[model samples]
Target: MTALLRAAAGLIIWAIVFASLYALQGLACALGWDKWQIAEASLARLVLLAVYTSGIGVLALLCWRYRPRVSRRQFLDRLAFAGAAAGLFSLIYTGLPVVAASICR
Candidate 1:
């Protein structure tokens, strides 16, 4: 069970971050967060940026933490590391639109 969880943790975190960001984006748009300015940027943009940055940071951490060590040549460890790398790539690819595109529209 532990080994399976370790292998799947990265993908699981990716799903969670993806869903949370989607929900938060909707909420921000509905609440007119774009009208609220923070540091010359809309509150919605800043909030999304913050969450996106944190998600990236967390995925990076997981990648580092689960990296296969020279001594521990375990298949599960390698899988976990690969999962984290894939998750990081996916998160960046999917979330870039939020940063570059209009929030309300």
Candidate 2:
């Protein structure tokens, strides 16, 4: 419900995205995805990470900017957004191996 907490959540989400992308790249290499596949997918992942964080940042800034009618709800909503984004990263991290294994076979 505070700006500090919202910003902290944003940074935590960013770190999760960074770590997930690094791990996924490693998995692709381990799976022997060619350079082209790895490069292409990496770029896509970067864009996804940007969009995920940017969306949350915008919401946080909006809460800070306008002090929305439902301020407490907006604060928690931003936190939930970051948490969901991190969850998405975790799912992708856990699933990439299964997906690559299936395809690599």
Candidate 3:
């Protein structure tokens, strides 16, 4: 149903975001931008963290803006809320490693 698809929109977007960022980190490392300096960190790592943080912010705003509608709509509509949570979790999961690992190695 359209409602279900709508509810799933966040998760779908998160999936794409996750995949794209994951691939981009890999590609950046392969291209040696991982070792390129930005400020105190490598360009690739900074980029990864910045992007992941931005994704979290966007998801948070979307959820907050839609919370009323999601809560007032059918119970099934709460799937959007869940999707937002999952998206946040995935973004954090993907970004955490960047903090611990050397970008180029």
Candidate 4:
């Protein structure tokens, strides 16, 4: 497969997997919460988001390892690229949350 197609597939699968994990984790936390422990607490929400996002990073790395396009020469290069992509995505994804935290503080 071409690099573009591979990237797109990787991204699509990553998105779906992450979204499901996020939903399940959030739901589990909500279900386990006591009446006084609101699901919307800032720190709790942060924990969920952090876990969800880190899960995505780890999944992406695993995907990188299994990618068929990788050659021995290209292995480290591809892994580095995928890691950079994940890092960039995380930075952008959390931008709004960081800004909101700053404004609310």
Q: Which candidate is the best by lDDT?
A: 1
Per-residue C-alpha lDDT of model 4 across residues 31-105, encoded as one tens digit per residue: 653222445454445555565566556656756564446354465446545654664465446434432442121
Model 3, range 1-105, lDDT digits (tens) per residue? 877876786777678778777787889978988667877777888788877777778878767755756237666567777777777777777667767876666
RMSD (CA, angstroms), candidate 3: 2.2
TM values, all candidates: 0.96, 0.35, 0.81, 0.35
What is the Cα-based lDDT of residue 42 in candidate 4?
49
lDDT of 4 at 58: 61
The residue-by-residue lDDT of candidate 1 on 18-43, one tens digit each, is 99889989999999999999889999
lDDT of each: 0.90, 0.50, 0.74, 0.51
Any idea what lDDT model 2 has? 0.50
lDDT comparison, 3 vs 4, better candidate: 3
TM-score of 1: 0.96
Clashes of each: 0, 0, 0, 0
Candidate 2 clashes: the total is: 0
